[model samples]
Target: MAARTAPAQPAPAQPAPIASAVRRDTADAARWPDVARLPAAQPVRTAIARHLVGRALHRLSLLEPDGAPAGATAGPVLTLHDPQAFYLRIARHGLTGFGESYMAGEWDSNDLPGALTVLAAHADTLVPAPLRRLRPLWAAARPGQDRNTPQGARRNIHRHYDLSNDLFAAFLDPTLTYSSALFTAFPARFDSLAQAQHRKIDRLLDLARVEEGTRLLEIGTGWGELALRAAARGATVTTVTLSAEQADLARNRIRAAGLADRVEVQLRDYREVRGRYDAVVSVEMIEAVGCEYWPDYFTALRRALAPGGRIALQAITMGHQQMLNTASTHTFISKYIFPGGLIPSRRAITEHADAAGLRTTADDGYAEHYAETLRLWRQRFTTNKDAVTALGFDPVFQRMWEFYLAYCEAGFRSRYLDVRQLLLTEGTRR
Candidate 1:
């Protein structure tokens, strides 16, 4: 046999791009670049390589559309995996670049959560390498886009929820319940997640003392699940949501259910709602309102409820009083995920409620239930991944959603997050 050529030596990996020079491009240009240009930062590149390689080396490859090895560098590395493009912005401008580049389709990935896990796991390397200088700049820039402001809230709500009604419908249950924890009462009986959600609705209605012909007000009515359930129970319900898609779908669902006579959904802000009802219920919506608004939120509920009317509020609360490192997680969510959302502590909520002339009649912590709920959601989402992609959600969105569900599940399981249902009355009920 002819002497075999020595096994070809593997080519040396390229470096990452400099964080400052990553230019913003149009969506199309971002999606299918002929070559990837990276920063000259060697240490950052090495760190990124270590992170990526540590996760799943077999699945990792850098290539152009033609399958040729493409050049990649640190500073701001761009990855093109087809149908998704991701720009790793490693500088102060990187945050804006990351968000805008994704919107522009600058890079793609088949595995979003895995990519994030790699990045997050090596956060010490990924962050603080060159982005710390922007802290003061970002802090100064924050007030302008805060959730309490109308522009910020509207921007955030539109960015995520307004992506598409069809997309949400693909993953969400028929009722479109988007929030936290479904209390199944008897955990063993409800074999399906949807059925568990239905049971949770029943429990909430029972707790609210909802009766036939009773008027109900729902704040942040995601997909109108609770409102629909209340209407089915013979209660007249009015639900409000900031998402246009949610409002439209909820309206159609009500009509389809032939409950239009009693159920109405409005695309409106919670602060803007005005009316008195027999009962007011808010689910998983309080987090979107910053703690600065907690007093206002409770006061709004008091004003919205008729005397002796009951109010039910369900929300995710952290166990601690001080802000934790997870504050960065919240920041990322606000910047990329929920926008203008803030989870409050148990103390903050109860104290603010009492201050706002409302008494907490009952406080139920259903931490385990929420953990189970998230587990079910994550499983369903993963099992239906192909269907979800078919609905036009990109890999980044998929990753974000997966991380959201898994992180939430882990949080509840670890008591890092708590699910709370507080029954409130305008004043002490005689």
Candidate 2:
């Protein structure tokens, strides 16, 4: 036996063709990176991306969907449903793609606010050092037609506020106040939203020193709710708005409330508003005034304000750095929800006001209240989803609305954004 020739090893069992196919499939599945799209960019960029995201998450102690971070007390849990697609989109479009990914349902969170808080905490670090230099190239410019010109203002307001009264009513409280509610009661009940809204209005009126014989000018008559409230205080009120639908309904509501004698609603632009007033109050309206037109808006308001009168403005604001970074960018919110809208930072407000010969006398931030208010609105909208669809809004539109509410809620929750009641007087007051 020639050294006992090794028994012909049975041709090592050739994997069955079907088995080979199954094995190949398993290998292909395993080849997908734990985080998708990680290799979409240059090696350096890819490493930077991974490091930035990983470091931020770990710092926040936020868990990945299957309970990550081994022993850390986790915050929000992020689920990357299609990590590859999500990362690829982010690589291509940057921040806008981040929003697009959410819209596309490529990612999700167990607690949206918690997730946003984590992001907010690390906002400065989220953009890798190398990519930070390219932000200008990545950002989309504000559209020319999306200006807050008298014509553009009308177009933008009509796009959102003119959708339909019934549609808004389905979600808003009966007061029809579209701005942030005061929500004196934390964890507010549905019924409390109206009371809270009224409280918010009254507080502004009080701040403006509205009283009997006062001449009140309101910019942005939101369905006439604020005007009605002001008029009820015995002040003669003149309110203006660019939305035809809001004007029509607001006028009717004024008549129905039997306060038409005290209040006048006009479909007019702030730039065209002409009367002087003892008090001026604009609630959540200044956000529509593009950064370029803020000076004009404040000048007009200043012109309309009488000697010794005060202006009470309810505004939504973001971090100063965020405002600076985003001022020139046309964002998802501006594109879909409010075509020409730009939320002013407190710094922008004060600067513009000072430029217009006004000074901020008092400022109060109620960002947490706004978060609760949005939660209530979102709840109502979800409850009335069927009614919303019946009003001719398609699924995408509804989802967009839902996302809008949730996004704002998250912003406020994270303290990355806020709503403030600001009291302003002539610069001489300072």
Candidate 3:
């Protein structure tokens, strides 16, 4: 969104230093240490995890220590340099720990997205029935303080969005847009990304019917890309964002685009928005509004919407069951990347909208495009590693971003994740 094989396979006869390679002791990188420096799992638990992981290698090969294959496999090869640490990490924290192991240099794959797609395809079957029954005892719930209260929301936004504009600039296109771009074609050339981003933004504006003299409101202004485009279409935009860094950069970008009078970038929360808007648009910000706050979020949108106004949103989606499964559980994304983010399902989106007096008028799903988008981003990110490092991000941070991008790409490729553009208007059922 985000490798090393630095750890060695310790001899069984000697004690193991499982946490040695995984520790983020860099003084410069203190901001993003690994989530909850994991303790080693009990031997029996480690053995059971090792058994399950080995059993789950249907679509990929797991290369254990000494270059031995975990099983007969046919897809990407996951090479494990520190098999003990990797297995024990999975044993301790399951999926979160698996991601931590990767961030810590425990395992790696030449084709990370391919490997991750394999895992995503087998996610349901990875843990056997008996072990699945025991998940409640082993799984950890999300931390309470990570809730999405007005104050808590700002803290969550800052953790990820405030990382650095320079850091984001290293990977994103010139527009600095972070959500899925609606590509005109698949396997699109890098040169065309900015165009694709404009295409995506323009579509949302069109769905909202933004036009000359339209009073537009954009929730989650992503560096002013949408606002600039909206202003160009003669719509006056009042965009809001919680990240101070984003607000400053967005205002500067809008001013430079000569759209300052047409677009207003506010360092404000959606809850604090006042007055009514003729058109409303939000891109990928719903994910950051935790499920618990979705009602309040949609209500705020409805309150801002004037009569005959339309609302458009681009949301990353998951299966309803999957959303329920992880609603209260902590995952790798929630832990290391976004503190309180939770992607909603399409069903949840419409239900909440309807409850807030909004009716669905259009639905468009194009997750395959998102996979390509992530692929392009990861390509640029990997190419600009030196620049990223120059920005003071640690090697582990680089790998974390690598893993995140690949992981999300795999989710889309495997149909485990989805992205949609939804159009809604105030209406009652016929």
Best-performing candidate as measured by lDDT: 3
What residue pairs are clashing in model 3? 1-404, 1-405, 2-401, 2-402, 2-403, 2-404, 2-405
| Residue 383 miss distance in model 1 (angstroms) | 2.2
How many clashes (backbone N, Cα, C below 3 Å) per candidate? 17, 1, 7
Question: How would you encode candidate 3's per-residue C-alpha lDDT over 198-261 as one tens digit per residue?
Answer: 8888889889999999999999987889999999989999999999999999999988889899
Cα deviation of 26, candidate 1, in Å: 15
169-243, model 2: which lDDT tens digit per residue? 998999898988876445664438988888888889989999889999999999888888888889999999888
In Å, residue 40's CA in model 3 sits off its true spot by: 3.1
Clashes of 3: 7
Candidate topping TM-score: 3
TM-scores, all models, native as reference: 0.68, 0.83, 0.90
Model 1 residue 292 lDDT score: 61
Cα deviation of 223 in candidate 1 (Å)? Answer: 1.1
Lowest lDDT block of 10, candidate 3: 1-10
> Which structure is stronger by lDDT: 2 or 3?
3
lDDT of each structure? 0.61, 0.75, 0.82
